[model samples]
Target: MTVRMTSARKAILEELESSKAHLTINQIHERLSGRLPSLNVSTVYRSLDFLSQNGLISISDMGVGTPVYEIMKEETHHHLVCSSCKQVIELENDLVAPFFEQIEKEKKTKVITNHLVVFGICLECKEY
Candidate 1:
């Protein structure tokens, strides 16, 4: 499917894609408002929803108050989330093959998402 960007929506997307910082919708709108002062909150939200649904971006719950969005790529990785720091570490999905096979057999259902997130305190927090 071809993705066309309207001028304003494109501006919002460009802000999201260009940000090195993982930003919430508020952050996105904050950046865009300086450039496009007329940018509305709902437009930003709708654009994000559209981009996410079309596989143009990956929306991850980084354990922040709000979720963050990143440009979509083929890298299928999981997150090691730290409860103490809210840090999201991306790791390769090199494991879990056996569990997938077993689940599929027992449930007889097609596996949709193999993306698993392991959440706990990191070593630094344990030391404290």
Candidate 2:
């Protein structure tokens, strides 16, 4: 299958690649509207959905009200979100590989995910 990379897709990809935090569709639209001037929320949403379906980007529901989007990376990592302060901590996939393996072995099903978001109270939040 062939995919045409539209201007909206290009702008959204750039925004995701440069961002440190996962952004919602609205956030991406808001960030690019000034530059594109004609970009709309529905276009951004469609582009994001297409990219995600093609595995070009990763999407997660970081327990926030909205689903967030990020560019796909070589090293897969998971987020350790502080339930109290909502601080996000990036953790290597290796830390949870064994758990996934165990689940697959016991359940006889393949486990697949680009990223994982786990919630917990951080030390700073706990101390507060």
Model 1 lDDT per residue over 38-106, tens place? 879988889888877776766777778687876655665567889998777776766655666789999
Model 2, stretches more than 4 Å misplaced?
1-3
Candidate 1: lDDT of 40?
Answer: 91
Summarize candidate 2's per-residue lDDT along 1-128 as a digit string, tens digits. 67679999988988988985699888899999898989988888899999988888888988788999989888778889987889899888899788889999999989877778889999987886
Candidate 2: worst-modelled 10 consecutive residues by lDDT: 109-118
- Which stretches of model 1 miss by more than 4 angstroms? 95-117
- Candidate 1 structure lDDT: 0.74
lDDT of 2 at 50: 96
Quote the positional error of residue 9 for candidate 1 in Å. 2.9
Q: Compute the lDDT of residue 88 as modeled in candidate 2.
A: 90
